[model samples]
Target: MTSTVAAIFVGFKQLGIADETDQRAIYSRVTGKPRLSLMKPPEKDAVLAELRRLGFTTVPRRANGRQQLTGRAAKKVQALWIAGWNLGVFDSRDDAALIAFVKRQTGLDHASWLHQAGDTIAVVEALKAWITREAGVDWSPTGKRDAAYLGRYGYKIAWAQWRILHPGADRIARKGFDTFVVATTGTTGMWTEISDAEWQKVMNALGPQVRAARKAKP
Candidate 1:
């Protein structure tokens, strides 16, 4: 396919307008052919025009180098990263690990903050797809409750630490600990009902206790 047509396809994919079936239908509507490879230049141009009419626009390249991600894209990237962390796909909380993962996915060596809009979108889409395929989790701009908990307190890791520190604790002891946490953090409601800010507060209140538990003898 021509470069213009390829770019049009990428734009449609990014806009979430055309999947494989929809793309074939679009091609048939525009050029009387369902196969892109069969299209001549004129047919390709018609398809491109149709795509533009449907809100597909070419993204301009940065003159100096790759431009930083825009505000919306940056937020999406952050949310996906947090989702990955909660899903255990990303084990490290370091920003460097996120940058490395983005680079591997996008084949762009630049830091995530320096990625062009297209590269940023590609990374975000890939991350979303990977998360969905592996964990069956939908990627949202504001992450889910588990993501909030993990982002705030390293939830799984914290719990693992707690278990190691209190390996002999009984069910009643566990319940007592949970009660203490809830009362100390002023956290109410079920896990799903808690907001992200509330999770942060819960983690903040529990962090010191966990630390003190770690420092105490078994």
Candidate 2:
């Protein structure tokens, strides 16, 4: 069986540069300088060799440290790597920080699922839980009533807030207002039907702040 490192090394050998001199020149051209250590059998590839020359190893050298992970653990790590890379959680792929973040979010050291299920199950579960906790959505239904219902609940507050924010010509048509009520309240429409333009009028009348406030509350 070919190890990942060995596979990489073999690929470079197959490149068929005549000798060490040609190999060194090619590496220097690509990476600014030749890495003597990387000219050997176990090491090759300019970029990877450059990383090694800078004391950066893909597998940590510390005893019993998490050098590499496989299966579900690797999947979870990959997910975190992509997310952390995009969200600027870590400047580069820092395995230790990525693992720590996953552990903190999922409350487990490994990517074992809640039950023995699929490989990505743990990643999905962790993300779902984390998103629910951090997404800032109000889980409860909006519970926003129709205009008449609102008036009944608290007449003064309802009337004041529901007062047509738009001009008379811009106000929602009677039928459209009824449609908006049915859509928002999930109840029967109070009046006749209307076109899309009328629906827009109704949405405009309700105003963004009013809708946002309702969503924020419930």
lDDT against the true structure, per candidate, is 0.56, 0.41
Clashes by residue pair, model 2: none
Query: Which lDDT tens digits does candidate 2 get at residues 1-218?
Result: 22333433433454544476765665676555575444443234444444334343333334656545433246544543533233222344555665566677666543233112452466555653453343221223224553433323122212222432222322234334444556754445533343333433433445454445434553
Which pairs clash inside model 1? none
Q: What tens digits encode model 1's per-residue C-alpha lDDT throughout 34-56?
A: 98788887787678767766775
Name the regions of candidate 1 deviating beyond 4 angstroms. Answer: 1-75, 109-115, 139-187, 190-193, 199-218
Best by TM-score: 1
Q: Residue 133 CA error for candidate 1 (Å)?
A: 2.7
Runs off by more than 4 Å, candidate 2: 1-66, 90-92, 111-120, 128-218
